[model samples]
Target chain A: MIGVISYQTGNARSVLRALAAIGAPARLVASPDDCDDIDRFVLPGVGAADVTMKSLEEAGWPDYLRARVVEGGAPFLGVCVGLQVLLDHSAEGDVDGLGWLSGEVREFPSSELRVPQMGWNSVDVKSTHPLLAGVPSDSYFYFVNSYFATVGDDDLLATTEYGAPFAAVIGRDNIMATQFHVEKSGPAGLAVLTNFVNFGKAA
Target chain B: MLTTRLIACLDVVEGNVTKARRFEDNIVVGDVETVVAGLYQQQIDEVIFYDILASAQNRRIDLETVERVASRVFIPLTVGGGIKSLEDMHLVLDAGAEKISMDSMAVKNPELITQGANEFGRQCIVVSMQVKRVVPTAAIPSGYEVAINGARVFTGMDAVEWARKAEAMGAGEIVVNSIDQDGTHQGYDLTITKAITDAVRVPVIASGGAGTVAHIAAAVQEADVSAAIVSSILYSPRMEKLTTVAELKAELAHDYGIHVRPIVAA
Candidate 1:
């Protein structure tokens, strides 16, 4: 079963509906108890990093997600702010993140481009992974964010350019995330989620 | 590289997508869900639905329509009109809207903009301005006045100043809807649109006037807007030749040299 983490900050409903639309049934895992029988997990978020971090911390999600994704080696996916909170720190509210990944999130330089780079932009894949299997090269995904992750090249799976190239997709081991809204993006995005549910199945 | 966006603005009345000229004389176009789903299939960059009668009639926005559309359409959805408080914003967002647009309510209580932004990040709050070209005054130095209640009442706030203030107050995006050009189909009011876009750092969407592909191209090239909201030429029955989102994006890319999202072959 697929468990979509719901911390009252992310658009879990949309994510749930999107998953169902692609023939991948899922349920909202609001608490750790709801994570039972859930082999695959998805964290979908929108809003500030600080705010989302606060919600996750208050709801005791960090430890549960860490145990499930980091230690258990289950397939995981994060979207937008969901991707940011997995890093070590963020410049959004000068807040420390989950620290599962050795990286930091910084605001895009507003002098060169709009702060929240809204709308559709294509991603350039950096590595072959199951999460981006069917998604075509140069396929645009919906992005509405003011910050991007700066991670090591080992974990960087894809990069997209706004003012400059930023990490649009990241993956290490069983953990994967995208700075864009995979559920809200068009066909390309749906492909990512569909690939995610079937990530380790083929193996 | 980031591309300029082409947005579809649906003016909804009584749960049906309506086409109007200058915000009056509405004509029912089609069911809201079907039209929106079709636009999504055409690869429209984003979609904004304004509940035109919600505020005037003092009612809540149609969340059913929002839920229906957002469920089927996998793109950013922004809903405006009748959003007065943080609770209303929550309801809309819970209904699957990515952004909440405040117009007259923001003008009445400016704190609502900041409050919503504080609660649900600035990126989810969009301050929509109903602007009309008026005589330049000391108070309205931009030669444009902000209108409220669907352009029924004109506020003394300057359009350019409002755009800047909205940004300062944490509005992530601004929609400068020209009352004069709304449904007129002539084109966007570039004068005021350019003024507001220049005054604010946040993404400004040129709305209220969109007739042809050239009009949308002009908004992007001349005003330097982030997006252009097109309505009439896309699906209105009044139009002699209705265009698809794919055709418009193709024209802008091929002729005007404006970069848009590459079309995903069906």
Candidate 2:
């Protein structure tokens, strides 16, 4: 059974529905105890960085999730604000993150481009990853966020254009994340979720 | 590399999908779910559902329609119409709406925009304006008049200036609908659209006059707006040949070099 982390954020139900669409059985797990017997885990969020951190702490899932992914070596996938929380810190709030990856989240510089970058945007693949298996180099995914994670060169798997190139996808061993919403994305997005499930099965 | 967007607006009344010309003559279309599901297979970028009956009754947003559509459609969903208070906004957002648009309420209480932005973030709140172009008289200059509640309330405010105020109050986006061109299909009101687009920094969605594919292109290219929201032409059975969003996007991509992805079939 695949476990999808259910914190006080958006896109949990949509993520579960997407996994189900790909013939995967996924359940919403609020706490680490609920994820004891699950095979892999998925973290989903769609809100401010500060609020998400508060929710994770309130629910007491951060330490549990970190152990599962770091010590237990369980495969993990994150989306939107979920991806940002994996970094060391976020400028959205003055709070520390999971520190799973070496990076920090910062607000996109305001210009003619709108904040949140809401709508479909293209992704440029950087390296080979199973989670990005069938997705095209120019494939577009639905995005809705105000801040983006700035990962190191080694951790970047894909980059997308807005005002500047930002990390669109990141991965390191059993951990993976995407700044875009695969559930809302069309065929290309479903393929990403399918690929992640396939990776979970292989692990 | 900004691309034009094609949107379809569904007016929901009493849990039924309906369309009105001047906000008076109502005609029932197909089932709201079926039409939405069908539109999801086209080249449409996003879908907006206006709950026309909910606000007048002073009730919360209709979660049934939101859940039914969100269950099947994977694209972005925006809910509007009768979103007066913060509680109303939360109900729709919790029900799976990506954005909540406010019209009469925003005009009545401008602080609602700031309150919503502070709570849910600005990106989720969209301020909608119904504009009518008025000729320059001795007292007022040649500008756009703002209307609300299906044009029932005339605020006598200029559309451009009101857009600036809405932005200052933390509106993430603006939807400018042309009352004069609505359903006429002559084309969008370019003068008013350009004014608002120039006055605001956020994304502007142009609505109200879309009869043909060319009209959509003109609204996007000429008015320099971010998205063009259409209803009658895209939903009318009489124009079945031109109803499909894929065909419209293809024509745009081929004719004007605008790349738009066709919505995948369910």
Best by the DockQ measure: 1
Candidate 2, B1-266: lDDT as tens digits:
23466778898876777877756677887888888988887756789999887777887778888878887887778899878778877778767677888888899899999988777677778899988878755433537888887887888887888898999998988999888887667788888898887777788888887887788787777877878888888785434444678778878778876656544455
For candidate 2, list the clashing residue pairs, or say none: none
Q: State interface RMSD in Å for all models.
A: 0.9, 2.1
Cα lDDT tens digits, model 2, A98-170, are 8899998988776656665767888899888888986768777888778888899888999998888899999
| Model 2 bad stretches (over 4 Å) | B135-142, B237-241, B262-266
Quick one: best TM-score, which candidate?
A: 1
Per-candidate TM-score against the hidden true structure:
0.98, 0.93
Error of 2 at B17 (Å): 2.1
Candidate 2, residue A41: Cα displacement in angstroms equals 2.6
In model 1, residue pairs whose N, Cα or C atoms come closer than 3 Å (at least 3 residues apart or on different chains), thus clashing, are none
